[model samples]
Target: MKRWWIGTTAALMLIAAGCAGGTDAKSGTNRHDRHTSGQAMPAFVEQSTIPHVREAYAFAEANADQLQYIPCYCGCGSLGHESVKSCFIAGKKANGQLEYNVHGSGCEICVNVVMDAKKGIEAGKTLQEVRQQIEQKYGPQLSPTNTPAPPEGK
Candidate 1:
């Protein structure tokens, strides 16, 4: 009877320890908490249209501050995208690590914008210069509309 009691007590203690191991003592939250920096990571799309989308995402995360000043001409501003940076990053962690947004993977335009910014940075262009070049190329076309009306009548 004494041996049985001791074994049961040890089993109970092991179970308690296992449960305790999964929680943070200070925060009282799960130890595997996904929150990094201050933002919760956004769910990335399962598939990307471009093969190089992952590289574009990393580039955007690494150069977010610079990309933030560059605007996107794809009309994504309606989706709350203020700058090219918004195409990739949702927010930053306290340690400065980026929480990425999934928008870039699905939108070729966003990915292209990031790629262009990366190229500009690699070419030693200042942010202002890059912004100017992008604006000149993609800003309002020569005419208000680049495409003519479909046809006089179908």
Candidate 2:
């Protein structure tokens, strides 16, 4: 009976650790934050788990004005993602504070686009120049109405 009890306790501890790992340490904010329209936004995953996601989020937050005009070719538009920035920022509050969207942490395309934009901006490229480069590379492969046909069936 003592052995069984110890095993059960260990299992419980493992489960608890898994649950705790999902929370964001920096914000410590609950996932049910209200949107401008008073709707509940989805919970965001912790960005620390993914390489470059945190940096991408930071760039998106810092350059929102320029990124707002840059289009995303990841087909997230159906999710109301107007631009690459929208994948990281859900909306702004009345006081101009940003409500971060956790979606970018899970999206490779979003992270790549943000990183590319950051590089371009650092190299002194104008917003229009960055937009042109991104569109030229990703526009043709956009998932919306442009995904390539699958290769012959396995």
Candidate 3:
């Protein structure tokens, strides 16, 4: 009976730990948290077929000027531009070779937009076409470099 109790206790503890994201084993975030703790974290982004990540970044950066830079109304307090990180692949570990982590940056909305845009681009959508799609999907209030708010006196 004592052995049974000990076994049950250990199992419960292990189960609890697993439930709490304790099983990160690699990146060590709360599983709930997008950011990880270690410098040598696993890749936070997924791999892309763009040949070069720079291209992907350029693609995202190009029309960034079109979207609005509103604060995340979701109360996360993050900016809309920050959501672009979801589009490109990032290395999971800081020094762990630059592979696409897919899980690192970007929110769900941003990720969906980015991935869709990427797909569209691959399917021969012009950059403008992709940007328009993003605008239509996320609204105009999501980009950053949006004409600087037309200045106060203008």
Instruction: Write candidate 2's Cα lDDT for 1-154 as tens digits.
Output: 9999999999999998866645444566443333343333344534245677767776777787778777777788888787888888888779767778877878888888888888988999877787778777787877432222222330
Q: Per-residue alpha-carbon lDDT of model 3 for 38-151, expressed as tens digits? A: 223333333333333433343444433322221121212233224344233332346663344343243454445555566765687665665556656666555332312322
Model 1 misplacement above 4 A: 1-46, 93-97, 141-154
Q: TM-score: which candidate is best?
A: 2
lDDT of 1 by residue, 1-154 (tens): 9999999999999998887657655656554333334232234533565766766776776677788777776677777777878877878568766667777778777777778878988999877777767777777652111212212221
- Candidate 3 lands at a TM-score of 0.34
- Best-to-worst TM-score order: 2, 1, 3
**Which regions of candidate 2 are displaced past 4 Å?**
1-48, 94-97, 143-154
TM-scores for all candidates? Answer: 0.59, 0.61, 0.34
Candidate that scores best on lDDT: 2
Sequence-dependent TM-score of model 2: 0.61
Q: In what order do the candidates fall by lDDT, top score first?
A: 2, 1, 3
